[model samples]
Structures are given as C-alpha cells and as structure tokens.
Target: MPKLARTIRFDESDAQVFSRPAEAGEWAIPGGFEFSNWTEGDLSGKARQAFANGWLSLESFGRATLVAVAQVEEAELEPLARRLADHFVQLYGAPDAEAALPIAREEIAYMVELCADHSPNVLLAVSRELTEAGVRESFRAITPAEAEIDLVAIHGSAD
Candidate 1:
C-alpha cells in the first residue's frame, strides 16, 4: 500500500499576540502561544511545560513530517495543514529534542478522533492550498513559545 501522507491536526496554541517594549522597561501586550501535537512519556511532560509556557500537541497518521503554526485564516487550508503536523509532533514528540520518541497506537486513535471532527480528510485540500501559497514543502515548522506560522499557497491560485 502507498505510504499514508502526514495527517493534519488542530491546535489553539498556534495563535498568539505580544507587544514589543519600546522603552527600557515597558508593559507589552502580554503575548501567548497555542498549538496541537502528539507527545508522550517524558517528552509529553516537556510538551506540558511548553503548554504552560504556551504550546500545544497532536499526532500524525504516517511518514513525511509536516509542521505548521497557523496565525491568519487566509482560509481553512492553512489551519488544516498545521493540525496534521501538530498531531505527529504531539504524539511522537521531537526526536531531536528528546532522546526517545514514543508511539502509542491507542493515543493516536484518540487524537484522530478528537481532531477528525475538525477535518475529516486531514488537509488534503489544504495541501493543495499550501502549494498555491508558494510553500514548496507541505510542512510548516512551529516552535514551542514562538508565535506565527508559515502558510502554504492554494494550488493554482495566487494570494
């Protein structure tokens, strides 16, 4: 069977807002982060911390890592892509950040169930959107505390 494409996920953590301090000391817009991914074991703990600091988790369905942090809803496609990548990262955690990666079948199913309600097909249409957005890679890299996401183009359409 052909390898399954990276499943999409949804995370509120991706959205955030912060104000820059103009003077030496100033109060800014007290920013925050949101996201969704698949994290487990020790890494899950870290992800929890990341969440406290501002990060979310979810899981992916197959190979091909696709990451994204959505900010603007140019449309539904961008958010859809981020959701898929978040799913995998949340479930497996960052292999580079953590020593061991955890893969749980049941957990994966649960996550899919949770996010499947958001997108049934899992961003297949969004992939085309990313292509149109001029994003060569379907994946959008997202950081723990950092805000903002790389959006993909809609196939055959220019933004």
Candidate 2:
C-alpha cells in the first residue's frame, strides 16, 4: 500500500494533517481532532452507493492516497463532492495554508480537477481520529471491484 501525507488547511489558523493507507482504504487522523456526528457504517453506505452507481474508478478505488496539503472550502468543491468535503471540514476543520510541497499542490489540483469531472467512478476516502469520543471514523467512495466483491459476499455467486 502506498502512503502519502498532506496538510489540510481550513483557514489561516486552523488546519489538520492526515496520512492514509491507500490500498487498505483507511485514514489515520491523529488524536484531538473533532467533527460532527458521523459513523463508519454511514461512510461505508455512501461508498457502497457510489460504487453501485459506478462513480469510483478502479485506479483510484483503493489505491490513491490523498493528504490534505492545503486548505479547501465547501465553496471550493462541486456540489456532488460536497458531502465528503463538508465532512472533512466539519471534522478536521478547513485547510489553513498553501500546500507545503509542489507535489502536494499538484495533488490538490488533481483532486479539484477530478471533482469537477462529477464522475461516479471516482473514489474518495476520508478518516479521522476522535479519541475523545473513543472512536475513529473512516469512509471511502467504493470502487467497481469492491462492489463486485460485496455482491459475491452477499449472494455467494459471481452471477
């Protein structure tokens, strides 16, 4: 699994950095971060829906690692991508500064471009550490391959 870290800037004074395990589809949010009410199952359900609708791509399904290297606002994202974006904002807070590295800036730019595509096949994974609540929430937009696996797991048949 490939790993990448990026700082998400919500504003000039608030920001949070996150690292993700891309292949495993998990986010490691450090303790002390807080966000609105959300559950792992809720995120999973959304991801499943995205997969069923063919919104997430195979290459990005569980492979793309995104680290918040810059601050992004809900206003900055397209309508469809807002749910996840807002979730991040509510949880980690918005980004506060420009990306620290050229690659990070490029990645953020890429994400912005992808969000504009509005394709259901594009997957997004987000997570946070809520140590105070004694819970950690992770979510992702599911991929076609994962949807097939889920189908097989449920029906016990490829058909």
Candidate 3:
C-alpha cells in the first residue's frame, strides 16, 4: 500500500484564514502549481497564509494548513489521476485532460513518496515562498504524541 496525505483540521482557523478551506479528511497534495506565476506582491493576507502553510486538497481544490499521513489503495490512483487531470484542464487551462494526465500522475506520486517514510497519523505541514530564483517549498513532520486519548476525550459509564 502506498502512503498518501489527507487534510486534517483541529480548529476553525483554517476556515477563517484560507480563502477556501479544505474539508477535513480530503486527500491532499503539495499543489505548488497554484503559485507558479506568483510574486512577492501576491503574498498578502490569506494568500500569504496559504503560501506560508497550505496543502492543496484533491477533492475540493481548497487549501489546508496540515495533512495527516494515511495508507492508500493502489486502485485509487487512476481515478485520482483522472480527477487531477480534469482539474488541470478546467482551472489551469491545459489544452485537454489527456495532455495533463502525466503531470497529474507525477504530482500524486510525489505526495505518495513524501508520506511513505512517515507512519500513519503523522501530521505534515508545508511552507512556500517566491524568491528571485523561483518558488521554494519546505515541509515539516509532526508525530502525534503516544496517548490513547486526547484532551477533549469523553468517557461513558453504564449501570
């Protein structure tokens, strides 16, 4: 099984900060293509927040601040690739999906490789910026603490 990144949200801030916040649990990719034509002036307000730390959601085509590593079935790849290709044609103005398919596959593959070494449930965040050379991106991994319950967990008892 290949590992993949999925969006995760701990609070409402993602909704407040991003122009379009990705739904929780949506599949994600680095999505640097969105910023390929951007310059420093484009980095302002929510756009700046997105550039600083956002992963692109595959389903909503929205932005996420963090993603969790998850296992992916091999069968899911082709459909996802097709969806990405369609998105390229529709949004990025690719001549056609056939012409965009290869690039979509490569982008998905890159995200799969990025998650492969990390265990499931590990969180990943990305930071991006444009410099004189070009767009630059960096990533960081955060491992969840080893605990059976989180701070907001609930308990139930029955008689």
lDDT (C-alpha, whole model) for all candidates: 0.27, 0.33, 0.90
Using lDDT as the measure, what is the rank order of every candidate, best first? 3, 2, 1
Pairs in clash, predicted candidate 3:
none
lDDT of 1 by residue, 22-53 (tens): 22111111011122322233234433333233
Predicted structure 3, TM vs. truth = 0.90
lDDT tens per residue, model 3, 88-128? 99999999999999999999999999999999999898988
TM-score of each predicted structure versus truth: 0.20, 0.22, 0.90
The lDDT leader among the candidates is 3
Clash totals in order: 35, 21, 0
Off by over 4 Å in 1: 1-103, 120-159
